[model samples]
Target: MEIHGPGGISGPDRPELKPTEAQRPDKAASTDKVADEVNISEQAQLLEKLSQVPAVRMEKVEEIKRLIEAGEYETSERIEGAARKLLEEL
Candidate 1:
């Protein structure tokens, strides 16, 4: 069976595809002299530092777990410190 169409796939009637500005090789050469810049705000840097910090301190958690298991997690000093922090927040 023979298929017949307007241009039969790569005929002269098809418009040539041109490279977009981003795809042009000269675009990169022209931009080579121009240095790319990135300025991170103080808040962004602080947030990045925060991201590097572990969300949970596993060692502290494990220590607390052990203390609680031994019925020694709650102490007068810890209670006083917690109460002080609570009052300070108010």
Candidate 2:
């Protein structure tokens, strides 16, 4: 079957039958390929480093626990200061 285009220009009279590589212009390689490259941003590296740190400091936790056991952990001023700081963070 003949395929018609603009201005009545006809396509190939017959489809290719075992056309060689050089005879087939449409078969030419048109795209270029390169090796994939990946880059890590500075922020990502910093986040990764931060993730490696422990969420809670065991030494500080133990010290606070000891103070509570000694009946020295509940000063009103200290509690007010902590509450203020927490509100400020929010």
Candidate 3:
């Protein structure tokens, strides 16, 4: 189908085709299956409780600093694989 724009050019634009199959994890999907995850008071209480704990263990902090200085880390390689799969689905 030709969909003319203000520029007056036309091209094929079909909507019947499926989405590109990129798995967008919609956050709202959970709403239908579960009650509200947290109430304001409960959330405040939880936040207050969490605030009482030490932010991070000293040993963990040191390990993280050491890793950062030494450049020791890892990255997931699954993104490319997932993209390939989604393209295939499309």
Candidate 4:
């Protein structure tokens, strides 16, 4: 058993292939790039929401730091609750 390819290289008959106009390099190279249309309404809304957010909160950071320094951050009960929730998820 044998397999015949596109040019019938393995068969008795061999057909000649002709290239079309569209397949020519000169015709292909002449094509132009098209610009895509975009909707800016959603993007503008997202930008407005992002701009409303504060860049930083030094007060919150200082409070958290103070809590840690006073040995009050992350109680054992909170740690156990978080671990139980994680175990439930798994």
Residue 83 in candidate 2, Cα distance off native in Å? 1.7
lDDT of 4: 0.81
Model 1 misplacement above 4 A: 1-35
Model 2 segments more than 4 A misplaced: 1-36, 41-43
Pick by TM-score: which candidate is best? 1
Ranking by TM-score: 1, 2, 4, 3
What does the lDDT read for residue 82 in candidate 2? 97
Measured against the true structure, the TM-scores of the candidates, in listed sequence, are 0.57, 0.49, 0.29, 0.39
Local distance difference test values of all predictions, in order: 0.86, 0.85, 0.70, 0.81
lDDT string for model 1 (2-90, tens) is 43776555655557789998777773365347779999999999999999999999999999999999999899999999999999999
Worst 10 residues of 2 by lDDT: 7-16
TM-score result, candidate 1: 0.57
Q: Write the per-residue lDDT of candidate 2 for residues 2-90, one digit (tens) a residue.
A: 44666353565544559687787774466775779999999999999999999999999999999999999999988999999999999
Q: What number of clashing residue pairs does each candidate have, in the order they appear?
A: 0, 0, 0, 0
Clashing pairs in 4: none
RMSD of 2: 12.4
By lDDT, the best candidate is 1
- Candidate 3 lDDT at 78 equals 54
